[model samples]
Target: MKALTIEPLTRDAFAPFGDVIELQGARQIPINLGTTIRYHDLARIDVTDAGGRAIVNLFRGQPRVLPFEVTMLERHPLGSQAFIPLTDKPYLVVVAAAGELDPEAVRAFVTRGWQGVNYAKGVWHHPLIALDDVSDFIVVDRGGEGHNCDEQALPESLWLTSEGLRGAAG
Candidate 1:
């Protein structure tokens, strides 16, 4: 039987694919929790108020990925996206350009996020990967009327196993 080998996920190497938003050192800026913070005098406001609802899709059942097949797939065209791996060990994050999802390029990434994870806009990738375990997360995206989402399952099953990565690395 064939096997797949996993590798480490890096930021600089992944920049060409998309933004690797691994919060290495971002501390919480306390600004009085109860009061609404308004800013009209600031020179530049970096935050855009996109009034949207945060949706949390809980999966009580175990997360399973078939051999050479995708477990969870999702596409977002509007706001930026994120995939926070719930496990402490390394997981997989396969991303590609919009309308440019190649299986070869997708197979190259096997990074991990320890704290939290978030990806920038227009980055195409699988929804969430729990690596060796199942994970649950709150998906924050533009939840409005209109269809700006597309999810495609590959015709052939593609498994990311330990042997597979070692073969590719060689």
Candidate 2:
């Protein structure tokens, strides 16, 4: 199995697939009598295509351990999908380009508990890869019309391991 090295999630690195949602380097706005700081426009929510509407979902994911098999990847063709970690623990994201699933194009990223990602329309990605234990995510995506979810198998096997996490930027 080809092993994936987990890289630190950065806006520039992930721009090809989607936006990196985080508080750092975001436009801040003061609201509600200046009691709240808003991190504005962190991501573009593009769920309104083909009579679709934006929707919020709570995705509770079970944890995965190392040497994780990379068998399949999925994508949303109709709109973008965002996963914001509700649990203050690190997680993994595996993604590829927008078109066909190239096993060689697959990349892995590790979030710093506070960061999130918005997968652009049709970008191939693995489902949530929560670590250690059960985790929760606030998912924002399209809710109506057309087949948004598509899953495909990998050409070959790939594995993500603990060593990858250790190599990521802390």
Candidate 3:
């Protein structure tokens, strides 16, 4: 199997695949008598298709060990999907661009607990890869949809290394 090194998640590096959800360098607006700071419009929630609506749900993700094997990737054709960790634990994100499923285009990102990601519509990505412990995430995605998901099995398996990924920023 081929090996892929996981990189740190950053906004600029992840732009082709999705939006990085973090407060760093984000627009802030104080609201409610200046008691709360609002990070407004951080991610583009593109569920504007007919009969498409946004829905919020809590996802309990099972943790996966290092040197994980990746055999498949999936995409949402109708709407976007966002995953925001609800706990202070690191997680893994694997993604490719929005076109052909080129194995060479695949990239991996390890995120801090406070970070979240919004996968753009038709963006190819692996499912949640929570680590450390059983984690819960606040997921935002489309509800009413025709078959919104498409899965593709890789012709060859890939391996992800957990080491050499810490503290390396994109």
Candidate 4:
């Protein structure tokens, strides 16, 4: 199997797929009598589809060993999903554009310990691949009627190893 190249997560690089939830260049709003600064509009949450409502969840993900095989991808056609890491550990994100899953169009990224991602509706992506330890994430997604998740098996599996990681920013 061929190894995938894992790029460092960046807003520009990840824009085609969805928003990157980070505080680097987010809009700042001073609230709480000027005692708190809010990072406003970090990501767009779109869960209102087919009677679907936005729901918040706490997800604890087990760590995944390196050289992980990516054989399939899933997507939510009805709503978007956002994952905010509660644990300060790097993780892997694999994604393909919304539409038919073309394995060749797949891209991989490695997040900094503080970075998070929001996969837009209909965007194809692999499940969370947490590293180092058991990580927790604040997941915001759709919850209601209608089938949302769709999984597709890749034509061939790709392996993600440590050596494949590119600029894993500290």
Candidate 5:
């Protein structure tokens, strides 16, 4: 059995692996919406497209807490889009790739990397599993319009707990 680790989500920390989309602090910017108001850089956001055509949908809803047995699915030729965690204490389930096609030595690794949005596309990963409540996510993907979407399940099960992430600090 493999123990799951909770990692803190930070821009600098997650930069090595993928784009970290979260507001580090407030930066005032002029509002151009036919009104005069200051806009803050609430979160660092990035957008992805395919052949100048976007295939993603943005939906707003409360964040969903995941179970310990959360398993990841795999995809290829497409990138991933995720939401940045905003709660004071947020947790995420990160899984590494496994199989002969996986060039990495590790097999199905899981740990917490960032509290904000982090995703791996053209890479192997699990489905949506939230760490807190009321998380607003800006989804990025190749748009589920075609048949290129591929998902493969893992044999070994994994788990996540709040106690595990208590000591992680960004």
Candidate 6:
């Protein structure tokens, strides 16, 4: 199996796959008597074309150890999906561009607790990978009629390592 070195998540690095949901470099608006700072339009919720509705749900994901094996990836052809962590725990994100699975084109990223991601429609990505204990996340995705999800097994399994990601920006 091949190995994928995890890199720190950043908006620029992740732009090809999706949007990185974070307060850093985000548009901020002070509201509610100046008691709260709202990050406006952090991610684009794209479910309009699927004839589906956007739904928010809480996902409690169990942590995974390092050197994890990635055998499969999935994508939503009709809509996009976003995952926002509810706790201060890191997570891993594996992604590839839309189209046939290309092992060499795959990229891995490690995200901080404060960061989230919105996978664009047709972008291939792994399922939620929570780290450092059970983590809760706010997942926003399409819910309703058509089958929006498409999954594919990789040509070969890939191993992902948490190495070289310490203190990296997320």
| TM-score, one value per model | 0.59, 0.97, 0.95, 0.97, 0.60, 0.93
What candidate 5 gets wrong by more than 4 Å, as runs, is 25-52, 59-67, 84-93, 97-120, 132-134, 144-146
- Candidate 4 residue runs with Cα over 4 Å from true position: 166-170
TM-score quality measure for candidate 2: 0.97
State the TM-score for model 4.
0.97
Where is the poorest 10-residue window by lDDT in model 2? 161-170
Candidate 1 local distance difference test against the native: 0.49
Between 3 and 6, whose lDDT is larger? Answer: 3
Which scores better on TM-score, 3 or 6? 3
Residues 1-170, candidate 4: write the lDDT tens digits.
Answer: 87888889999999999999999999999999999999999999999999999999999989999879999999999999999998779999999999988899899999987889999999999999999899999999999999999999988999898778644544
Candidate 6 is scored at a TM of: 0.93
Ranking of all candidate structures by their lDDT, best first? 4, 2, 3, 6, 1, 5
Model 3 lDDT, residue 94, Cα: 92
* CA-lDDT, candidates in order: 0.49, 0.93, 0.89, 0.93, 0.47, 0.88
Clashing pairs in 4: none
- What is candidate 5's lDDT per residue for 1-170, written digit by digit as tens? 45466566555555544555543443656577847555364433232434323444554445444335645455544445554443354445454543332322122222242334545554455555554554444564554444445665555555555555554544
Q: After superposition, how far is residue 37 of candidate 1 from its true place, in Å?
A: 20
Tens digits of per-residue lDDT for model 1, 39-99: 2221111112255444433432234353445533455655555444444544566565566
> What stretches of model 1 exceed 4 Å from their correct place?
1-7, 23-61, 65-68, 71-73, 85-87, 113-116, 165-170
* lDDT tens digits by residue: candidate 6, 43-75: 988987747889999999999887789999999
Error of 5 at 124 (Å): 2.4
Which of the two, 2 or 6, has more TM-score?
Answer: 2
